[model samples]
Target chain A: MNLVLHNFFRSSASVRVRAALNLKGLAYEHVSYVLRKKEHRAEAFLELNPQGLVPALQLEDGTILNQSLAIIDYLDGQHPEPALLPESALDRAWVRGLAHAVSCDIHPLNNLRVLQYLDQQLGVSEEGVAEWFRHWVDEGFASLEKQLASDARRGRFCYGDTPGLADICLFAQVANNRRFDVDMSPYPTLQAIHDHCLELPAIVDALPEHHPHAN
Target chain B: MNLVLHNFFRSSASVRVRAALNLKGLAYEHVSYVLRKKEHRAEAFLELNPQGLVPALQLEDGTILNQSLAIIDYLDGQHPEPALLPESALDRAWVRGLAHAVSCDIHPLNNLRVLQYLDQQLGVSEEGVAEWFRHWVDEGFASLEKQLASDARRGRFCYGDTPGLADICLFAQVANNRRFDVDMSPYPTLQAIHDHCLELPAIVDALPEHHPHAN
Candidate 1:
């Protein structure tokens, strides 16, 4: 199965899909886009994904899957060797809820584009932009830490034992949090899970620093 | 199923879940919280959902589901008759991608909390707040209109003749957009889909004004 991942090295969303693909043992090539350079906004890339977002996976059949979670879902469906979600519907909901807490509630607010808007458009100072970043992360990670620390379902990863969708999202977000100096001491559960994720080669290889086009 | 939905009347995320429940013919009790009053931050509500965000569905066994899309996905899995997601993996990817375009890309940035942050913390004026809302809607809608209009899979709704996940999110967001006076002229495809959604009682009854706690 040939796959081409259109992504930037430091995109948390890209990190998610890359980790998922590696976890599934699916080999894929990278088509790097320098998001800061607006390469993602180029006409050719726009044709691939009109959303102009990175982490689009192009299937061998020319189908492009956008949205990191959606792409991960599709890959899970098509592969299913190491499942990304749990078996039961209720469990899947739990896992998905954990994932969205990061993706929807935090990452979207702190992503490069939103930060750029806060700085360039809203005239927020650099310190203010960093504050904005830490703000969302703190809000999200606080609850996530409480949820994970209390839930008996949480094992070495977000769920029982194996790394799944929630773990993928958590790992990526924790990595992104470092850039903003987000205080992980407040989130021991999340910090531990992120540490556990770091031990896996599949997850480690997906890190931005390990990306082929890392600056 | 003895479902209790803790949500605000006008939250777009709440609207999405409400429409999904209505579409699936699931009966759930409303537990309203006025977000502007910080009612969601109440200790009781925090016990239910540590995240303290609304649209949490409490099941019979007392398991609570948070995140609107996650709750919708759970409902779809439990009640498969009126499926929210498409059957095929690739098709499901397309539908989810469209849904996330609204939920993750647009809704999160334009939600009450973010707008409040922009206004209170950053001192963005009323018009600036409105501009911020419209900017994201336009950025997301422009690409979404392109994707939906160009794709052969699009029908009366975002995916096919039937209203599904994408339609639920799109409809809810368009409703939210009305508050900011977003001009819909640029997104004819989305506008048409939103129009189609309005014709359904399931969708119409889920509107904020129709909620039991609407002020």
Candidate 2:
């Protein structure tokens, strides 16, 4: 199945979809949009996705799938070999809870647009923006560390032995954390899981530095 | 199957889960937490969910499910009679995309914690906090209005005639919007869908006012 990923190199959400596609061993082309240049907000891109968000996967049949988690879910359904979620309903919920802890709780507050808003609209200093970024990460990662460290179900990844949805989100968020110098000492479990994810070629290939448009 | 919901009455996330449970006809007990009083952040509540977020669903088997969408997905999987998502993978993606548009994009930014951070931490005044809230709601609703208005699959609800995931999220968001006085005039489609959701006993019963501990 042909898929074209419309994304930016630095977007954590984009990192998620790219890693999911690579994990599933699905070949897809990249249509890079430089978000800082307002390329994603262009009329043509907006026509494709009303949300105008990065990491919109245009399927072979031209259906534009938005929302990173939703796109990942679709990929998991269409290609189930390397399952992104576990088997049981409860297990899936467990994985999803981990994923949302990053996606909904952390990344939403620290994404580029929100930071830009903090810098421009709120007149926050550069240091203040960095502080805001680290604050949310610390809030999220502290609990994530506690949860992962305490859970018996956790293996090398957030779920079982394999990397799945939670791992994808955790990997992306940790990678993004580096930009703001978020101290990782508090989240040993999260750091270890992130380190394990880095060993996988699929995940490493999806990192920001590995992207074709990365500066 | 005994189930208990740990939640706050006015939380948009809690409202989503309550509506989902009602839609699935699943009976669950409500354990209220006043977010303003830092009740959800209490040691006892944090022990149940390390993330310390409300709207956690505890099953009879003692499995606690966090994240409103994940909890809803779990309910949909276990009780598939009134399915929250469509059958096909692509259709499910569309529904999920709409749901995430609210859950991930809109609600995450405007939730109680984020607003408090803006008010107390950033020192954004009352008017500024309200503007900040409306800013995100408008940004999300504009694209949502465009997408829903242009989609043919939309019916009385966000999907077909049934109240599904998208409608649950949209309903809760619109309900929350009333407190901030968001102008619904710009989103006719969303306003109409929310109005339809209000007519449903399942959805209506999930409103904050119906909660036993509601102020």
The digit string of per-residue lDDT tens for model 1 on B100-160 reads 9888999999989999999999999999999999999999999999999988998899888
lDDT tens digits by residue: candidate 2, B40-117? 999998999999998899999888999999999989998998999999999999999999999889898998889999
Assess the local accuracy of residue A136 in candidate 1 as a C-alpha lDDT between 0 and 100.
Answer: 91
Assess the local accuracy of residue A1 in candidate 2 as a C-alpha lDDT between 0 and 100. Answer: 55
Give the Cα-based TM-score of candidate 1 against the true structure.
0.99
Fraction of native A-B contacts kept, per candidate: 0.86, 0.84
- Report residue B53 deviation for candidate 1 (angstroms): 0.3
Find the candidate with the highest DockQ and give its number: 1
Error of 1 at B152 (Å): 0.9
| Clash number for candidate 2 | 0
lDDT (10s digit) by residue, model 2, range A64-139? 9999999999999989989999998899999999999999999999989999999889998999899999999999
The reply for model 1, stretches above 4 Å from the true place, is none
Clashing pairs in 1: none
**Cand. 2 Cα-lDDT:** 0.93
Query: Cα miss at A171, model 1 (Å)?
Result: 0.7
